[model samples]
Target: MEAIANGLILLMLSIGHAELWTSVINRTHALKIHEVYLKRLRHVLELLMVLFPLVLLFAVGLSDPGVLVGGEWSQLPLWWQPILLLCTLGFLGLIYSGVRHQFYRPPRQQTAQESELIHLRERLKQDLIGEGPYHYLAGLPFNEIFSVEFTRKTFQLSRLPEKWEGLTILHLSDLHFSGTLKREYFIELCRIAQEMKPDLIIFAGDLIDRMECLDWLQETLGPMQAPLGRFFILGNHDWNQESLQIRQTLSETGWIDLTAEPVRLQHEGQTLFMAGTEAPWMGKLQDVKLSEDNAADDFLLLVSHTPDNFHWAEREGYDLVLSGHTHGGQVRVPPFGPIFAPSLHGTRYTSGTFFRGSTLLHVSRGVSGIHPLRWFCRPEISLLTLHSADKK
Candidate 1:
């Protein structure tokens, strides 16, 4: 009976591994060496599939006291069982390594599809900027609007007044301010923000993507002055040592870094609580200060680099949560939506506004790119308006 169970487990494991391999091949762009890798993967799978049944048979046949464990090992086929077991374990390890290699690790070389995508992006850039092939990529200064009216309940609960209800919250995130992000574009983005006359401005993590470009970003960011106070939070990218240097530069030049912390604001006689969470999803709220005297009354607004804590904010009775990191799946399909949404929730609420009861979760598509291309989803800056209860 034990032998049968072990055999069944092995069979199931074989099937599962095969499925995983199939999925990886289907999703990833094929390379020249992919065929060789595929053959090795298939060989490993076949070995497991073939050995599982044989191992089962051996275990059953050796069930009697004449087997190794039964002290009648001399009469049993001892070598075959040990050999099969060793082979199975080794093959399993190979499969595991393959899966890990394909998903977790970066690709050694760009696939044909990736190369094509780059070319396509270059073409689009040439067309958009009216430049030659090697003119260098310049930032296109464009305004991205993400305006939404608030519910009546939102205004009634918070004393922000009916007239000022439609106040805009300008949001920027994941500004990979390095090779591609030109100095002019940063100033233009800040100018646009100023021109829009936003009631509040929020920098939701990752002010710069590369550390080497910190000086350039700082030069651009220095001239950016908004009417409302600007608040910033640390992103996962910013936590890196290189990014820390950029953060220090920003810190020196009037950019506030809120790490798992919340600050209270009194705008137009309304109390607003803005909190930021430390990223990478440790499931703990950092830097968020809750006032014990009147925790419930504060119109709590939370910012996280990743939208992992949407449920967390909802459960904690937050009014609104702002986040980025999904980048609208960065590359979304028409009906199927984003191909890769980096979250526990997969593609659900990849970008835009989602409601967890009364709590609003706004995931920005982001301002720049790490991969240098977005298929369907364009780079964005979210503009959220706070409406009063009476206005509704």
Candidate 2:
């Protein structure tokens, strides 16, 4: 009985220790460290999990368990035993609570059909920005382990016009084009976008990272064609002195700049109102209010760099809002979700499709970012299909 009790205690302690370590690992920010070092640490931790039980068994067997040769409990003051028992009980309670929470948590309602464009995460092991000796040695080995998934989200809107029910908008954002990412990458992305054959292409923001990459814009993004048109808005990154040149380059490439004012398009016997606001970081957004004349029977769509305008969009009675800035927190951990999101409201509107009353907001993880590393948080191209809820 004493041996059995000791074994049970050891088992509980082992489980608790492993659980505590897992929680710490999931919550800890490891992006600051080099990839090579983090990989080595992870390997060591995995090895320890296997060795821990054996070590515990050996220690427990060799140590005194307050038992006598007569098969009776020792009478000597074992004050520490009660304390150990209490700690074990507390750990057990914590484990139970975690399990219950996981099992009882409500599932998030999904409105998107997610599909992988490239299985690069499984195929490639080199980083996208393969430069410098440090990156080659530390990051390259783990490169391309990150995915860039394309999601098709269909939102059933009661106010959606019947003619626009099948209208597909291919949303792209945060294409942080610099020397780090080659033009070939963008060309490949354009090929994929072309194949998807969206009726409209909307670029939310962050088209270029630096002024030098400005020339590559037309060659890279000019190939992406849509039947209706391709519209673009400026991100905070685009609000520099070179912005005028960037806008000119985009215009020459046959892209419509929707930054100055809202544009109304007549498509398939229905009116579609599309508007874009300047990034809040780049000073105040232009006062493009939706009037009663513009509101009647038309589908209102707004684009912004950040999801900060979700409330504003909701208040303005916009049917849909597309955005990308947070990069889906860049790295997401299972159970804990996104570790860090660059938004005013934090991780509240990080990524994916969200319903704010009748308005649907879709935030993309984006094609690329300034930082090259992405874990469970994959970069994305969002394809949104509008469905009229009333027709269904």
Candidate 3:
């Protein structure tokens, strides 16, 4: 019976030791994951961490009493129990050291100037586009090509004539129109865009950053008119968890609300269908049901908040898709690119125009900041001019 008790004690101690080590290992693993970009892995590790403690509790319950007490003080030497406990505690300390060494320490830090310069460049890129004339007056940076000197971006239509080459589409995105930005900034941008005489105005989303300011925003944005029409879609930030009063305000002002719906526009004998999809982050709140058959036209444009929905847009036979929400990383790192896209697809198809099969996706950086400050990737207004292939 004594031998059996000894055997049980050893089994319990072994499991208990392993249980403690496993917990330390899990914590170390979680810490290591922070160094890498693995959101899913992080979640899994968190779940394992909780489960491991429960497993340890079960192990403790099943363990022999003497094993936990180290064969007892009376039965063995009086010092044995405390010594065994100390040894176990010492073992735990060793495991903690191993975990700390293997995981917790941060990577090497860059020099202050190097870090600052990196930050400066990122800010420069983010703030390079999306400001109006006054934003420039405020000392914003814009690429020379997108500056007033260039004024326009031309695209050659696959099959069309030279006369239609000047078909201009003014692309504005992520208005973030709230108290944060001066109301005049948007009014000034609208005035400037009106002066440009765009054939169409496409607003990708986030008309109001906060739902409370819908009335003020609608009044400010309502008068802005384009020769063709003004179109808008829903952005993730559009749906404030409060009541959706913004949606009602936009509808009242004749803002062609395209949240999860399709609108067809006919101009100069060519038909173009504009479709908007549900914001991916919204899950079931998205309510778009467009098919290519429904958009049987010369051109199809899909407007979305995030670009990961491009596959669906392409499959639906969209000629182009315009989106925002990357903010060009809102701060970028040279060569490394934007920090992220805010989509499950990572940084793919973020903050620029990309060709996906026959579909063209233009991911605008945005017009305003959630905060007035911009570091690298500034706000932008995109002037897209479509050129007919026949002209050239």
Candidate 4:
């Protein structure tokens, strides 16, 4: 009984210590770390972490530690008693922190006015193209199936203008349309999105993966209908293809390219100023300067491919920002959230809605990825309804 108790306490301590160190690495180095090397290191660390407690138990048992051998408290070495007590307290503290973070933390409130059923056809087949042998060997091919979840989230802000109340915007991003994802999949997505009857449509870049899918854009994306208008910005992946051609194609399809310029529109008696910036990775982010004089009483909105611009948007007094790029970290782990997110802040701005001062940032998980495998992270198309908190 004594040995068993000691072993359990030691195990908890080991787990707590491992988690603390892992968090340090994830928060500090994950963004800068190389993918393959980081993955390999994480795997090796996990294996060693799990085996540590067992190895420690064996060593203590062989040495016949007084505490493990059921010796009286007073008979145990004075130093050993304090060490055990400290370890036990540290483990309990870790447990308390975990419980508090899980149940007591105040998460941002997200209210949904309505959500439509994600209609997936029964005959929709899973098709994997150009997938390497590693995918099949690792059972990742099963995760490559194209599916979408349509979410309608309402954001009520006290600062929101009453004239723009109940404004619905459809947000789409990261349509990594490589050969793996078929044209029909996007067509189905657009069909469902059109049914939402959004007042405006915003595409936050990474619309195409390769040049081969360029024709699919006009055939599938052209049919999307919106009452107000459609706007788009380029992402890192968009530059992989001919950026000029993509911009021209979008213009020809009646989609306004908001890159590097702010456009003003009158909607429902409200003045809306929508602007976009080139992705920071593309070296043209500086060109997207917004003029203070142009903002005149207009509801300012920005479209950025990466959430890294959230700070800039907030500093410039923008009310809302739509962005994508992290793809919700591609794979999310419960409680711990995303294991990796490609940003300077790591997983801080990976996905979902966030508030920076008065600026609200919505980061989409995206329509698709370079590789189709996604676990616990579903592809998303969001319908955002903006409401004035002051109205009610």
The prediction achieving the highest lDDT against the true structure is: 4
lDDT of 3 by residue, 1-392 (tens): 66467555444444344434434433332221322334455456457545643443343323443424344324544554664464366445444443432342211110011011112223234434233323443354432222211135556546333446578788888777655545555555666666667888878876766555566655465876787788777666665423256666766787787763667677777667777764554433235645536635457677777777888777766677788866655555444444334555544544666665677777777766454445555566767777655433
Q: Which regions of candidate 4 fall more than 4 Å away from where they truly are?
A: 1-109, 113-145, 283-286
Overall lDDT per candidate, in order of appearance: 0.55, 0.69, 0.56, 0.71
Clashes of each: 9, 4, 20, 0
Candidate 4 lands at a TM-score of 0.72
Worst 10 residues of 2 by lDDT: 26-35
Q: Can you tell me which runs of candidate 1 are displaced by over 4 Å?
A: 1-164, 281-286, 390-392
Q: Give the higher-TM-score candidate: 1 or 2.
A: 2
Ranking by TM-score: 4, 2, 1, 3
- Kindly report which residue stretches of model 2 are placed more than 4 angstroms away from their true locations once superposed: 1-112, 120-146
Say which candidate scores most in TM-score.
Answer: 4
Instruction: List the candidate numbers ranked by lDDT, top first.
Output: 4, 2, 3, 1
> Candidate 1's error at 78, in angstroms?
26
Model 1 / residue 272 / CA error / Å: 1.4
- lDDT of model number 2: 0.69
Reference-based lDDT, residue 105, model 3: 23
